[model samples]
Target: MELSVTAVILTLTAILCLYYWNNRGRRSRLPPGPPALPLIGNSLHIDKRAPDRSLIQLGRKYGPVFTIWLGPRPAVVLCGYKAVKEALVDQADDFGARGTIPSISKVTNGYGIASSNGPRSRQLRSFAITALGHRGNGTSTLEGFVQQEAETLVEAFTKTQELPFDPTFRLTCATANIMCAVVFGCRFDHTDPKLLALLHMMDENMKVISSPWGQLYDLLPNLLDCLPGPHNRLFENANKIKSFLREMIQLHKDTHREGTPRDFIESFLAKMDEEKGNPRSEFNDENLLLSTFNIFLAGTDTTGSTMRWGLLIFLKYPEVQEKIQSEIDREIGMDRTPCMGDREKMPYTNAAIHEIQRYANIIPLNLPHTVTRDTEFRGFLIPKGMLVIPLLSSVLYDPSCWETPKSFNINHFLDERGQLKHKDAFLPFSIGNRMCIGEKVAEMQLFIFLTTLLQKFTFRSPVEPSAIDISPLSSGFSTLHHPYQLYCIPRRPARRPASE
Candidate 1:
């Protein structure tokens, strides 16, 4: 019995020594960070609900570049303007690869533009950017599509009859319709059941992705997969979106002709046919469906959420809204719709839009990036597969970068003459090779949609503007503004006839 006890003690000692040696080696190689416990790592230090905020706090303690052990895997977080810019922009190629988030990868099956890496990522992303850039025909530019959707949105708001309503649903539909037109070569009515269902799924997925539970899933996917929770529902919703896109693909296939591609879907189909015989080609129905899913998911939520936040911010600061309206009225007038060209001339309006994006700070902790090869960054060795988070919030809210980092200051984007001045650190769409694909489309949507709304209406909340909580409702991977109602009072046009 004593011999057996001695043997057990020896084995336990050996395991402990191995564990310590492993952790010690990792610690020496990685950048400085807070101490992490075994198994859970630094999970306890992170506020699951607001990982971005937690990370910012960590940045304060550990400097710009530091490693945070996310469940035994060290993630080297690049914080503030300088570190992020250096890593993402200066060393772009080294930090260009997309890191796998188990949660996102499972849903995407490592196939889509958002989650892909190396050759596949390059091929799909290049094609996607080109497809997104082209005017559908000679006449149907993306700007035109956005303007048309802005009209539909105006009609929907008009039906609200100046009453207070949660504009989230309407705004989501308007944004999703624009994406639908781009992807499927069609638009859905605001009341379309299928569109509403699709939006519901997308919104739910966003909520899950931006919730504390979602972060937990990303950190502990295998463990959480075994447990019953909302994470399971995220997969269900992903499948639903895929199934819906597949149906749309089938419809496109049936109606497809040889000569002209109507939208992104048809364009992809033509590419697929061209590459049908190429064994290494990434063009396939699976990619088409997943890429379409990426476009639809990204195109809808981001712009919609930003616009929603823009309205909320307007309610929060009426003066800013009025200033933008004045600028729009002066530059574009009310009779005609605002175009992308008007943005250059309307400085304050442009400034306010930039301020909105900066203040909102959506996607605070950017999608994770990975090193393509073993890299020495800032005196620390980050292995090839090590996850790197470019803390976008740090840059947007960096004191060194912005004069008033914490406040809603439109002056951040304005020059002494009140002209819109570009700030290098205003990285709402992030930077480098993996910058947002839908940047142009999003810009157009925000400008045209917000300008259209402001041209016809003065937005106000029933309560005092100062009382409105502009802080995000819940933050995880993304920041979501708290749901609020607003009154849209129609404004009389200054230059044109009322009927016109």
Candidate 2:
């Protein structure tokens, strides 16, 4: 009976694929791509683990702007700096819509800024940016919170005391605390059970999302939904986070004071109450919960991973670390903590941080975008609802754009005079309307946390710097550096100590 059921299911799947295959040619003037097979489409041809690499190779053959069918659905990929810029930046409106990614949709339930489109997405995104900015004003309060966390982080590293140790949890905790302060209006104790669980869930979700299994779940969610796999755990983890958020929302509602918004949640709750009667209002408990989830999750992973990568890179390149430390010593000195304002005077340190982001290329295949309407783009006719990916890896590593795209050279962001220079192609947070909502917060975190560490310690790895592998261990939604232990040796102070 089981065999018969399996056979029937396969037959139905084959028929559906045939139907999609037959209708595929009906769409006219679609971007060019490699020929795809029935049911699987280009799944066989592409590398699930490193889809960006596969897509980059495909871009070379099919030109910068081309199509590749994920399953039955065809996605138009804008590759290289020029192509991605044209679509995401120059032609922003046409490609502003968010694609219905099954994996994210399942978790987000078609709500929140990451998955929502049209008015809802716009409303939430705008409100989120405003709320996040208000919370993370980058001046007094936010900087204080970050600097405090950096001190805690330095303390944690000092505990290691020249012993090689993994800095993942310490880094993640520091980063997550910043998010907690911004979103939840508080910070989590390093030993808090709930906070630890939350961080674990966030880390697991990130790993799963960036895993090949995660891509498979996204590609064939329905089938994978039925089968037993890690995807199920992914959904379960999302529910746990959502449940936590829901509980927090209720607590906020119970304690919320009108006209006195504490943080992102209070501000959103206020909006939800204001728009309570409007039928078209996107502000609600569901959105508030999911939007909070989106911010917390996004805020934690990207910044945490980047900082971890920065430390690893520092261990890999001690000379670069020394350069940044010297700049910090000369400009700010050890008595005072590094702040965003100091980023202006420290060109080499600024360039190194930018280089870390560019080299990290964390989110290589940025959040998938879609066509707002049936639009004509770059001599090709892209229909509405088509999945559009502005390959950020292509842009960040485009040979024509950077002096040395492949290498981790800070000179890419430095002029001949060794002053900081801006490169238009640095889109690690992506570009235009749907770019990362937490870009500013992430930037602040990276600059402050990294500079703080550099000021406090000189990092060295167990193995020789040249032996360290800078290439990511995994690459799907994001590129994660291979886990490695490093020694954090505290630097002697050059200035008088300030009062704690």
Candidate 3:
């Protein structure tokens, strides 16, 4: 009897899935795409390991705006700068809501800023901007945090005796340490076991999420959740990381002051206390825990990964490294630390960082967005709550917008005059309302971190430069670098400041 019941349930599931798939694109006036199959929609069309590559291929055939199915759901994918800018920037109000990530949405449960929509997102966003420190108003508390971490990072590399070692671990620690100081008001010692374990979890989480397992889980979450797989490791690590955040939140609860907030956690806790009487406030324990987790996942990984990609590129082309290091030496000299102010004076270094961000596909398909209400975009009807993907790689690598979209060229971010020239399509942190909240902090961190290291050391790969493979090992949710070691030989520039 049990077997019969299970068979009956399975039959019903298949029938419903088939019914939904049969009418996939016909029901909605979403932009046209290739035909979808029964029960699977267009899952087979996507390369599970690297969905962005497949998506880019499809975009060429289907045009900038088109509909594709990820399992039973019909999503509108916006490709290229013009189409993406039209929806995300031109109609920011309709496309500002956050969409779901089924693979881990169960874990987050729509409580945090990254996963939440509407009122909660706005409230959290407003609070975050203020807490991250005032960027241009000269009250940049965040810059001090990043600069301190950058100095420590340089010292750590200097201790390696200029031997060849994988800089991934040290770089991760350096970037994560900045987040720790911003969030918790303290930085961890470079050799701390606690910090090491957290970084390991982060690294593992990235691997799983970028693998086929994570993509499959997102595509067919219902079926995959019942079965055991490598994607399970991602969930496990994410949860453990959340648990760590929870403990930290509890610790802050014991010592947090009301008006004198030291860090983001304290400021948030004080706000929660202020809003305790308000029934509709989004500032609660769960939001705090998940929001901080969102920061850890985002703030730590992107900066660290970009830096790693940078080293790989430099190893591949030592000449590029020479140009940036020369710029650093001439502009800042060896006596003073590099700051956000110096970024303007050193155009080549600034352009180098911009090109690295553009060339390294850090975030491929950016965070999913949703339609706030029934809307029309590029001659198609998009119903409220429909998932919309802004393909970031499409924009960053769009041929129309970039001179050498397929190549690693610093000239893309520079003009013939050798000054840093900003490109309209270069939206690495993304553009419009739902853009990354930590943009200012990240720019400061990357500039200071890169320049500070160059101030004290010159990087060289163990093998000859030409033998190094600059290609990424994997590209799914984001690009991942393979294991490579390098020498951070100490250096001091004797040249005088160029414009001083």
Candidate 4:
């Protein structure tokens, strides 16, 4: 009995020694972060509730660039403009990898541009840039396509009539329609069964990322895999979306027109055929499906959320909205829908849009990247596969970069001559090789749609506007508005005519 107890004690001592040794070295080398308990390093510090604010506070105590662990995994966060720019741009080659979280890994299967690494990432990036076109704002064809989508959006909004109506669903319809046109060369009405299913899946996916269950899943990925929760439901929904993508891929293959690609899927399908026999070819049906999936989720949700916020911003700042409407009236006139080209002529309106992007500062830290190889950041040794987080919100709201970082100021993007000024810190779309692919399209959509809507309607805050929470809700993956409604009143086009 004595010998058995001694053996048990020895085994426990060895395990304790191993744990301390591994964790002690990590603690000393990395920047200061919230204290971790035993095996769950900083998991409590990074719980789902208000992660962005928690991270910001942690950033305040630690330097702008510091490391935090998601359970056992070490994640290096780059806060502020300089840190983010330096890491994401200056050290672009070093930090080009994506983390394969259990949820993402299961969903993407180690493919797709947003969640891949190495040669595959490079191939995806290159193919996407090429497909999008390589010149000014990529292709003029894309701009024309975006403009057509904008016209559709304007027409949709116009159909809402003169009564006070909420623009959320309508804006979502328009935004999702743009994605539809871009991807499958089609648009779905707000009631389409397939579109609604996709939307629910998107919501579920994002919800899983921001929930406590999501935190638990990330912290205990292996254990969580066998459990039942919303995370699993989200995964199931993701599979449903993937199945839809496969159906679309098969449809594209069956009905493909030779030498005359009609849409994004067609172009991609043709490219896959061209590179089918090549050894380095990553352009397969799976890649195409994931890419389509990424575009749909990224394109629709982010833009739709921004427009919703845009309406709220206008409701808050009536003067800014009035000025923008004046500029739109002078440029596009009554009865004419604004085009992508109209943005260049409407300086104040353009500046306001830029200001909206800056102030909103959505996607606080962009998608996390991993170090491709062993690298150095200011004499600090960053080992291979270390996670690098680029905090874009810091750049957008950097006091050094803007006169009033927190307030709604349009002059930040405008000079004394009333012309729009570009700031290097204005990286809403991010910078470098891993920069967002659909930025130009997104910008064009925001400008045309917002300007067109403002020209036709005057958005008013409902009675007791302060009751509305302009502050964003923590939606796991992204910062989203609490489901709030706004009153959109149609303005007589004659009252805001160009002659005025």
Best by TM-score: 2
Better of 3 and 4 by TM-score: 3
The runs of at least 3 residues in candidate 1 whose Cα sits more than 4 Å from the true structure, single-residue gaps closed, are 1-27, 136-139, 494-500
Reference-based TM-score of each model: 0.94, 0.95, 0.93, 0.91
Tens digit of lDDT per residue, candidate 4, span 153-269? 666666766455677667777778777777787777778898888887776777777688876786788888888877788688888988887887788788998886666788888
Window of ten residues with lowest summed lDDT in model 1: 133-142
The sequence of per-residue lDDT tens digits that candidate 2 reaches over residues 124-160 is: 9999988877656577487889989999999999999
TM-score of 2: 0.95
- For TM-score, candidate 1 versus 2, the one ahead is 2
lDDT: worst 10-residue window of model 4: 132-141
Would you list the clashing residue pairs of candidate 2? Answer: none
The collision pairs in model 1 are none
- Tell how far residue 210 is off in model 4, in angstroms: 2.5
Q: Write the per-residue lDDT of candidate 1 for residues 1-500, one digit (tens) a residue.
A: 99999998899778867978866765578888999876578999998878888999999999999989788567899999999999998999999999888888998898978989988999999998888877422235667877888988898888889899999999999899889988988888888889989999998989988887888888888899899988888999989889889999999999999987888999999999999899999998778888999999988998899999999999999998889888888888888988888888988988999999998988899989999988888988887788999999999999998999989999999999989899999999999999988887788888889999999899989899879999877668788888899988989955556794
By TM-score rank, best first, the candidates go: 2, 1, 3, 4
Error of 1 at 406 (Å): 0.8
Model 3 alpha-carbon drift over 4 Å, by segment: 1-14, 21-28, 135-139, 495-500
Query: Who is ahead in TM-score, 2 or 3?
Result: 2
